[model samples]
Target: MTVRTDLLIVGAGPTGLTLGIDLARRGVDALVVERADGLFPGSRGKGIQPRTMEVFDDLGVLDAIRAAGGSYPVGMIWQDGKRVGEHRMFDPAEVTEDSPHAEPWMVPQWRTQEILFGRLEELGGQVAFGREVVGLTQDEDGVTVRFPAGESVRARYVVAADGGRSAVRRAVGIGMTGETVDPSPMLVADVRIAGLDRDNWHIFPPHGEGDGFLAVCPLAGTEDFQVVARFPEGASVDVSLEGIRKVVAARSHLAPDDVTEVRWASGFRPRAALADRFRDGRVFLAGDAAHVHSPAGGQGLNTSVQDAYNLGWKLGAVLRDGAAAGLLDTYEEERRHVAADMLGLSTSVHRGEVRRGEATCQLGLGYRESSLTKETRATPGAVRAGDRAPDGNLDGVRLFDAFRGPHWTVVAVGVEAPVVPEAVRVVRGRALESYGCGVFLVRPDGYVGWAGDQTAGGLGYLGRFGGR
Candidate 1:
């Protein structure tokens, strides 16, 4: 049988689910297919950076995410079965009107996917489990994906969110350029344990020159702890229950039996890689398929989610809002640069050259150099075009509330509002300190697409993307 859709998203992990949610909310017909029968069952990629929290807020899942997770605890160092010292997980940042969510929130990867999946289903999105893309052929008009069961899916566009070892990426023949961030293989597991207090993240440093460090962090909102242990270079990691218990007993004061339940386990060597290209004809790579991080600095999942956020609106505009096809080209033009920067940041954090502070939070990320951005103001204010539209109050209305949904917004801050397309939402009021005195055209994804001192420049910029 042949199924058809405007967009076919491979892998129902955070990226595909997020793209599905965004497209569904825009009334765009998109399908998300995954090889696995269900969501990823692990606590990996648990750090939800403050910027991602804003993305979740726009997607309408922030409340659920905040409810399901808690703040990261202080790190408690252990040596010779005794407490040594304390370590802060992230650099402190104050919550401001513009940046409300200042720190990283901890929720297991599985729960985040579940919440996204739930939101997708609620928005009338569809996910076909067990549909693996074994082969793919793309024409000028659309791409046809083949499955092992002889089923075929034809889509105007296809996205690969399948992961670092992406089948669709291979089918498209995209090459990944990367380096091993660390030679030591690491083991990660989600386990239920006794004898450990949940107040702090437990850390056990390497005992000797040849030994490796181990860390056990309480997975918030669940009775489980995420254990990460490193092995000496060239040493194989053991992921079995007994293997984990042995490590825990040797590294910490807890006994082997203290690890009462081993929920899941996996092993990997820390590596950083990025696809040579984000797009290949009608097929585009996203998430781990596009760029694989070291899992340090908590950038992989957050960057992946933002990829979906970046591509979703462009897809919706082309398919639903009569946008020019050239608008889609900006996806690679914009995201490729961001991915390269994030890859560097992840590697830096893994090597301890960069701290997990303002940089890792991702609020500073933007597309100032993108072709889509129009900065007509000669002397720009603190907030400029291509910067993220910060959350704040304008005339007693929360800016985020006005920016919510699948529509563009015009924030006229102490300026005459331009005549925009009837579809665009406009808010006129005194200049917000975060926005400054200008006419800001906010994209549906919450970035300032165009900013100018007057209305003429802003109106023309919008006309190119159906904003007129």
Candidate 2:
């Protein structure tokens, strides 16, 4: 018998799980399905940027995420089997009331997924593992997704978060346009090392012309050290324990037996690609399915998570909030451009043209050009419509506290608050430096949707999203 869900998410990774949690809290009837028998077991995409930290905060998993991870360690470079120099993994940023998380946090991807899954469960959400989509058919009403065992699911909307080799993306005939960021194949593995200190991310530069760099980073909150080694162009990477041992021995002072255990291992050639379109009818592409990025800048996962954050609210608006169906179109219009920009940033980091600092943190990403954004101020403040709303205190109310739920928020600073629907939360105060004299309508995703010197057009902007 076929089951029915309002939304079907095709992946159990961070992207799909994040979307599931967001929708679940919003009381949306959503199901997440994974082709694998269990969650992805790897330490890939371990860095959680500052922007994602805010998203996690709103999702009610920030404290758990913070407990499960630690700040990134400084890089320790070695040469001639001895300590050589030091390098900072990320340029530092000061933590302030507005931006709390200043740097990236290190949490193995597996642990991160587990935390997200647990939160989803707490919100009364469920995921069906081994439910691979073998076939898909969609019309104006909804999409019917088929599985190999003759089971099927009918969803009003389908989200493809199934990773780079997305079968759903293929079935939908979406093309990915991209280039190989690097010709050299790299091997990444999570292993227990007997002779390594967990204090620093060990780096060993290539000693010869044909050799490549090797980095072993300690996965915070765990004993596993992620081993990443680059190989020459056109060389095959071995992902087995023996292969990893060989690479470790040949590149560093560590002996072959130093790598005690290989928990997970994988190999890939870095490439940057973007889906020609993020949506086709009722199905949407997200995460690796939408845009594949090099892991250099730690952007792939963060960008993917934000994609869900961006799409989740819009889906809730259309499916539950009685908003206009046309609002869904802004998902592609807003996210595709952000994805494109992030793709370029990751590629640049891979090429060493950029550093893992502010750009990598992702706090600066916004939708200034989005059609959904309305800036009616004669002179916009530092924070404008389409910019992220900064966290601060306004008349004894914390801004983030007000913006936490799956609802719109109005930050009226040094201005009289306007009448708004009960669905919208309002915070009024004397003066928030981040936000000058203006009324700001913050979206569910924490970005300012409308900012005005006066409350003239703010209500009309809110009406578009069923806030009236």
Candidate 1 has what TM-score? 0.99
Candidate 1's displacement at residue 334, Å, is: 0.8
Q: Report the lDDT of model 1 for residue 263.
A: 96
Q: Positional deviation of 55 in candidate 1, in angstroms?
A: 0.4
TM-score of each: 0.99, 0.99
Model 2 lDDT at residue 446: 97
CA shift of 178, model 1, Å: 0.3
lDDT of 1 by residue, 1-468 (tens): 999999999999999999999999999989999999989999999999999999999999999999999999999999998998999989999999889999999999999999999999999998999988899999999999999999999999999999999999999899999999999999999999999899999999989888889999999999999999999899888889999999999888899999999999999999999899999998989999999999999999999999999999999999988889889999999998899899999999999999999999999999899999989988899999999999899998888899888889999999899887788999989868877898999999999999988888777777777662
Ten-residue region with minimum lDDT total, candidate 1: 459-468
Q: For each candidate, C-alpha RMSD in Å?
A: 0.9, 0.8
| Global lDDT scores for all candidate models | 0.93, 0.95
